[model samples]
Target: MNVARLMFFAFMAMSVSSVSFAQDADCEAVAGQRGECAEEAMKAAARVLNDRYEALIDRAGSRYIFQYQSRHEEHKAFLDRLKNSQRAWIMLRDSNCRLEGFENEWDKPSYSADLNRCTAKMSLERALYLDGILPAH
Candidate 1:
């Protein structure tokens, strides 16, 4: 009788342990899905911001070209300087964001999301700055 009771308790313990393991797996799977969803959302946001950046660049470039045609040599040099500054700004933005991604192991899932968010934020700021400088239309 004692042997049978021992076997029964062992069976119950094993059943409980299996249920616990399954629950753990389910939780991990759900967490992974949530992480993926967040990453995709971040990417979409970055793409939209990048489009805004490009639009601002187009407007600024058009303004610059118009001004250049009518300006003196000094003004033309100033415009050239602005062009150089913009190229440098692009390099800076990319490098800075890459460094942010590397802060916690570059291969991690969060790293790409961090990089995307950083790029989006920097581009948006640059676009706003360009828009502020552009001639009001």
Candidate 2:
């Protein structure tokens, strides 16, 4: 019994670790675009990806809210609360990213890069969260 339990836990640990590694790889790929778009005209590619991720997050959240409302029509107020919470989260995310951008007080482009990375990372996380809550189709 003890060995069986240990093996089960070990498998669970590996599963969790692999999921995290996959997430890290995804984030790295998102951040890696900086190198490809380093040229002058395409400099804002990171920011564009961040915006795209944020839009996706918003769409996922809306879908979740719609599903929730449909399933719980009596709790219509939940939709408003979710909207308010999402707005607050967006403000917090922007503020946090701005703080990250200021980590290197002098280099403007470096700051922009850091800020865009932060935004992309956070937006991806939010999108993942929203997707998890969405009703299965």
Candidate 3:
């Protein structure tokens, strides 16, 4: 009985160790995937925003060509500034993600967690910027 119990405990210990190792591996994989996910989401957001902004600009162009007094000139200017800010925001997000992902002092999961958070925040900011432009539509 004692021998059997010892064998069981040893098996359990090995099982736990393997699981811990797998967890670390999974964390690394997830971090990479999440980072890419964030970048792609940002790209899509930028693309859509570009189309919408161009439409607005086209509307403005038509108005000007027709010599209509643009009561919406302030709105157009605001959107232009927002577009510029989104460009800068994307730069900030990329730099921050790199900093977070490379923060591996001890080669551990904690560092990967930081990278995951960085990716998430970076992706989330794109939506927030878009919301500012289009207001939850």
TM-score of each: 0.49, 0.49, 0.39
Candidate 2: clashing residue pairs, number:
0
- Top candidate (lDDT): 1
Which ten residues in a row are the worst by lDDT in model 1? 15-24
| Residues 51-131, model 2: lDDT tens digits | 545554455556545655544443345456656867887899889988987876498767765665566556545544443
Cand. 1 TM to true fold: 0.49
Positional deviation of residue 133's Cα in model 2 after best superposition, in angstroms: 2.2
List where candidate 3 sits over 4 angstroms from the true fold: 1-72, 104-117, 132-137
Clashing pairs in 2: none
- Candidate 1: count the clashes: 0
Q: Supply the global lDDT for candidate 2.
A: 0.54
Give one digit per residue, the lDDT tens place, for model 1 in 1-137: 36755565566456434543453354357775634544454454456455655565555556556655643555456567667878899799889988887875556767765665566556545644554444335
User: With candidate 1 superimposed using the best TM-score fit, by how many Å does residue 133's alpha carbon deviate from the native?
Assistant: 1.0
Residue 1 in candidate 2 has what lDDT?
A: 38
